[model samples]
Target: MGLFSFLKKKSDPADAELVVLDTRLRAGEPSRLDSEAERERQRAIARATAAKIDEIELAMASDIFDDEPAWGSAARHPAAAAPAAPQAVPAEELPDAAALPASAPAVEESAILYANGQAAAAESLLRDSLQDFGRHERLPWWMLFDLYQATGQEAAFESIAIDYASHFETSPPAWQPLLPGPGTPQSAGVAATESLCPVLDESIAPRLARLLASNAPLVRIELGAVRSADAAGCAQLLQALQTLRKEGRELVLAGADTLMTTLRPMLAVGDRASGEAPWLLLLELLLLSNREKDFEESAMDYCVTFEVSPPSFEAPKRVSTAAPATGSGDRFLLPALATGDCAALLDAIDAYAAGRDLLVLDCSRLARMDYACATALQGRLRVHTEQGRRVELRELNHLAAALLRLLGYGQETGKLRDSLRLYPHRY
Candidate 1:
């Protein structure tokens, strides 16, 4: 009989009788038909039943169920079934369907574009942003102000100043033109002189006097190297500054911040133990640098410390100088933007680095560097490094630093010659 026929006979009377006989054989008790031959027959029947079960299981595990749709074969073999068509999602149900990507702030974008030498685009964007968002934001206004001043747009600057004053209900910032563009030589008319010393002590009093008596109209006293000051030095420096002001001579205090840092710690409110020289000198420096707010605060402190009347704030009458160069005579100040043909800039740097083993380029005013200029500068600095000389690019703004980094200037490396050394801006 076929396997199906044999399985169908499981419910037959003969099959029931065999099952009864098997049960009796398994009991291990003597039966009326008990014999060795009967026992062997029962054992063989039991083995054949187990083999049939194993065969059924093996068939089920194979492809035997493929033709049996009643057993849900489609569910068991999903790959064989066709996929259902996708249903469209409602617009409201879609994730972030109306959300747009966030963009950089208008002021930041304009500034970066200006730095990258896209002055027209930068100015246009600033103007548009001023119209759309200027009521709520002040940065765009200030940026436009600086842009106009830098580009020498006096009429536009004045027009915006009027709008600024009317909108903010206050006086607008004055229009001060920026210094000559990058690579332009300093004018010969101003006889500029530099004084380099490590400390502002009593020993330098005679030199200070000479500076005061000098015929040169412009004198820059390098205070970056000054680590400490005494009462005598402070008083002497104060006297020279006063004399210069009385004579209407131009004075630039290079690295005044560094000296201020050294002086601030030695001073305290209601403590005049260190005398008024340091206090008075710091106040004078603040005044000469056109820092009225800082001067006022320090003046208040001086008043409290000395129990005497503090000097009144006086705006510097001289033409406002550029940001104080922060180092000695060897330092080279980079312009606000380095873009387009930077041949003159590179030449100026070469001239500055000619006599010095160390090249110090100050980027305190540097806002951005175009790709070509950055590449050229990288090459120049690389040559300087290869010659066993060190190059320090100091006080770099974040934007300028990012460009230099993109050009592979300052890389993480094992040797100093491999990359440019960058000092981040202190502020």
Candidate 2:
């Protein structure tokens, strides 16, 4: 046959058989991956096309193919007829190939960049992954964090951390660098009176109580000597900071580098039992460390993540101003004393104690008391004590008395001292 006729000649039976086998393979029957024998058979068929067999094998091993639903015959599979692009995806918003959707390929590519020390490139790609896949996809964020660190982009790192916190309504993972003690530019020298002993988990509560009771506007915590701290310890530290913050006081951490190195991982492991977010503590630590950029970012992240799409915080519209207490006795009657209502009790005390030098909190009607309530009340009372005003705990039932005493509330040795009294004929 002439060369042109030979080129247009029909395929032989073997070649036609190969073509049909390729079609079957391309159909991607669910049964193909269901068993080793079936997969082997498909592999054997792919071998018929020596030139394209590698491509076929590679396609079969792909994560995209692996993710395909394999419920039935390939011909009947819904994906077989599905459109290539989603109808709802805005054309402009479609991510580039490097910004692969929640797939292993994207991770692998980013890992390659990181391994090659192309941190800026990795950072860019990972950021794209975050935008493309949405904030809930955590891997990109985690990967981007390492890139930021590698490049020493402290400002950028902190900015992203803040974004992570805001996106997650939680603190980003802690990456606390060690602090240089005393002589570091960030540290004001430890004051003899302000310096605290090394903080331990067991001491956190008692120390916090002392700080609040002393009503010091600024409490310095010396953490240089601490080698380790657990989640509970971190939580207590956070709680103390929060207490001070709510009362418009401040806390300073001295020698915090080592302490932070120890606490970072512990806090990151997660703690919901404290009924508080760990990030809240991390943010406080960030703020105290004078990582102002980091702090601002974290604060921003915290605010956006947790409080987005909300009006400013306020008492409910139905909530009227607390009515003026109508009594001459300077006794503040608390309707409830549970942890949830303790603040209300404090407000009531403040309202009635307006012009009086002394105020007695009447717990006869106090329906509940807990460690939280006792601590909060004690903290508030300590502020009054600092101002040379007297506040008393009176008419407490056994439970309330026990709770207050356990919390170190008494007029004599207790923070409240002789100002604290059990109900008459009750204890």
Candidate 3:
């Protein structure tokens, strides 16, 4: 029981030496992290752990657990044992992670490195693993997206976005809930609020019309008139939107217009209704999608029927007229024009008279015309009246007579001057 007491004493010298060596030491073991081989080993462990987690997530997403009949005590009934007898194998032969061969050793090692917090090193390794497993339809796209987004890797986001779109957009309805039906316009824009306007009265008009039909707490707007879509209708819609903001919901417009132009302060709706457009599916992502995403380029996939350029909205300046009538003297036989667009109507008239030197135009049956139409008519009269054969209105319908009279034009004397140009004409 001398110095040998702390060390288990062995009768022989060699045995004593072995006993001392085997005894547990008081000092903690030095970190094995510094060693290259040891570091690689830790990485392997981490990768395995991450892959296992991925497996669990994949199972949850695919509903494989619920789809499979419950087995053992996990079953609801009190005395349940195991799943009953025969198991049916899927036709495609589902990938069995438990039985799949180790096709990629480096990927497994890289996964380990990532789990060990050496994410940079693990990145290549994970890529390799993906390459090995990418053949399967279930290639862990979500996990890949999370990793890339977390790393702020733009290329990765683009690559993953493409894959995600392909998978979610093309898959059958059961597989992807967000894919739009046939004939819908596909899009991906940067800012949510900036995409509320489109030209040719196609953007806000139809959207506002549709909004009128929606039961959402927020207002849904559809554009009704092409002429008014840009100025008055747009302004009216914006004012309505301002009123809607205080209700705690947003304004959501569905159509071809980009978000910022369609929804933002460009129109000056003032107060609540102007604050935010209501929510449609993609628009709802303003609240639903938390992360800010950028586009590498404009996307060709989204939820709409058409992708229209912004320029086509400017109405044509020339007007079209029927061939000269043999009875230009009879003012009552004018044609009936039906156009919600004032500018187009005017343009057609201008073009018609411009081409034909001497002709008489009829407006007796002119039911109604919006501002653009009024503007166009004034523009044409300015040019034509000075040149002799000026335009004339004949059979004034009740609505037409009132419009012309209200516009400050009396049959022959008061010419159809551009009402908007000289005076601030209010609707």
Candidate 4:
């Protein structure tokens, strides 16, 4: 019987026999069917249905797989028809499918593993991939570099750097260790305190002066919170910075780049008829931060605008030995990975956000966030945003940013959710 005929005759004697035979096989009993031809036909239909289910599942899960070739093309052309394949393209013109790098899966897998605290497994997989396809792919190599740096495996990082340079014929990534994990003890020094406020106006100058008055050798100012700045505020803050530099006090300008972004629009290159304080402050920030390239460019602009010599860029005399604090003050640091319900994380965020109008979640170390956690976090953020409070997620990795974007935290119209801000990691 044909496949469809067998399916249509559901109540036939042959169907009953097939059911009984399937039940017996499932129970590990030997089948004693006498009709060999009928049994073979039933088995063929079963295999076909199972294959169809697999195809359906694949199509549902991923867009890469096409079901038309298996279902439509086969049905349109009978198996008896001879296949036509006479076209021959030059070897040079042929697409090199095998040579194409398949790095996304490997990169995502390694990132998830590392985020989940499975560093060893992630390292092993990266090493194996490097051995298998490292010559053709640079992503795995860079991932391995990041892994080593994150894990503080300096020796292994150097070893890989040498190999990477030789293989890629270029410089490998620099070893910039991430901040210590949560609960890691601060080094033996006076810990830097949080910023005074989120906005940089005339009022913040006195607060900064007080901070400078303190005897602490290392002063960390959270400039990331400064969303706006005025001339008076900028001048005061610049004076304080100059004092700190002259006194040789260790200064850490957290979020200086963010402050520069806020200041850039206030000053035009060579059109700086006013707002000289902001320009000077920007130059000071670049100089103190040891950003020579940025300082040089701004210095040239300063000279053209002010018709005076700009300050010379100076390298930092001493580097602070203390480990830089992560997520100071109102900022909550998300874990390396967030999955499942994430109740504890949500609670921590609530506690941090309580009695505060601005909520900053530092996601620099957050490598991956599953759908469930992303949903939970989005619900919490929505409530906070509706209550007229601002929420900022800072330095999120690409993977977590993508998931948040998927959940509607960031929209395609260049606007985020109401009172919500997402600062994805740069490079």
Q: Could you tell me every candidate's TM-score relative to the true structure?
A: 0.45, 0.25, 0.21, 0.40
Error of 4 at 100 (Å): 29
Tens-digit lDDT track of model 4 for 21-129: 8899899998886478867888787777656655555445334432221111121222433343443642212211121143455555765566556778878887988
**TM-score of candidate 2 on Cα atoms, chains taken together:** 0.25
> Which candidate number maximizes TM-score?
1
Model 1 TM-score is 0.45
What is the C-alpha local distance difference test score of candidate 4? 0.62
Q: Give the Cα lDDT of each candidate.
A: 0.63, 0.47, 0.34, 0.62
Error of 4 at 33 (Å): 74
- For TM-score, candidate 2 versus 3, the one ahead is 2
Evaluate model 1: give its lDDT: 0.63
Q: Of the pair 2 and 4, which is ahead by lDDT? A: 4
Candidate 3 structure quality by residue, lDDT tens digits, 101-128? 3353443454344333454665665565
Clashes of each: 0, 10, 56, 0
User: Candidate 1 at residue 124, lDDT?
Assistant: 92
* Model 4 misplaced regions, further than 4 Å: 1-187, 319-427
For each candidate in turn, give its C-alpha RMSD to the true structure in angstroms.
27.3, 27.2, 30.4, 23.0
C-alpha lDDT of residue 101 in model 3? 32
Instruction: Residues 52-132, candidate 1: write the lDDT tens digits.
Output: 766665455445433221211122233433342353632112211111113326655665676777868988987887766
Best first by TM-score, ranked: 1, 4, 2, 3
Best by lDDT: 1
List model 2 lDDT by residue over 261-365, tens digit each: 655554322233332344466666665555666566655555555553322221111011111111223244454324444566577566666776776554433
